[model samples]
Target: MLRIDGKKVYLVPFEEKHLVDPAYYAWLTDFEVVRYIGRDEYLKPIQFEKVREYVEELWRNRYCSFFAMHHSGDDAFIGTAKINYLNEAGFSTRTADIGIMIGDRGYWGKGMATDALFAICNYAFNDLSARKLTAGAVSANKAVIRAFQKIGFLEEGRLRKKLLISGEYMDHVLLGCFREELHPVI
Candidate 1:
């Protein structure tokens, strides 16, 4: 199993055992937890089998690496993170997209997300040989945007009124960080 350790948390490869956990499904269904993710699938009642199939599909994708985040001290599951290569067939492009979701409400507002980002960024740059990593957030999500910026991700671009959150149209902020700009905290 692949495990990436950070200051406050560690990430393990997301596995079938995670899908069996009720809390994992609850986090995906929680509006406040996933609202910024901009996926309408969370708004409806989701079946366990469908979620299982979705995770299975993700596992089948060779370019995507999914991880389940856990608190270091207590080993409590806190969230999920992923790195997806943008290349179609080969990894020569060395560009990828990174995303994280702190599903446990108790962990919100802490620096865990930043730590997770640092660990993932380090893995991408050092282990995966990624040249650049990109991430996106709703403009209204200042906290998430700040986390990315805190980790040296610069504003790359924005899509105006791209995400509809709580009936309000919000711009999607794009951010990117080159491998050289990353400050590894793990």
Candidate 2:
């Protein structure tokens, strides 16, 4: 897909050039940004090289399709969303996991995430022919969970204490949305 344009944000194919901005590297170590997503310990010094290597892998990996989320009006890079572990075309390859991160602090709690999630999910089910999409969020991350639900993902199960945050064990909510569950987005 060239791009998935949402009401407020546009999801473009992730490219190496997207990393040129200093904010992209800085968000990797921001405590508040990575908190419930795990990696809170990234409090250590930020290394641009290591971050580049990670994004490079995503760029080259066939099983992953990552997108740089940009605000529609100004085209400002806001964050990223991804579909990982995409199985090759076949009757059996009908499910994938979705992940997202709105690294821009200024955009937090502004519904941009919800918009991006819906756009990617549309691409997954409509374009990719994915039968089901799954996502996991720490139960403490209510915002992520709510976004998933807003996009039609239903709570399927829970992984108890699957995540350790702030020295406390937290449950992980498992969510899944099937093709039939999604409203056709034209």
Clashes of 1: 0
Best by lDDT: 1
Best by TM-score: 1
Clashing pairs in 1: none
lDDT of each: 0.88, 0.84
Model 1 misplaced stretches (Cα beyond 4 Å): 87-90, 184-186
> What TM-score quantifies how close candidate 2 is to the native fold?
0.91
Writing each residue's lDDT as its tens digit, candidate 1 over 96-133 gives 89999999999998799999999988998889988889
Q: RMSD, model 1, all Cα superposed? A: 1.7
TM-score per candidate, chains pooled: 0.95, 0.91
lDDT of 1 at 175: 97
User: Number of clashing residue pairs in every model?
Assistant: 0, 0
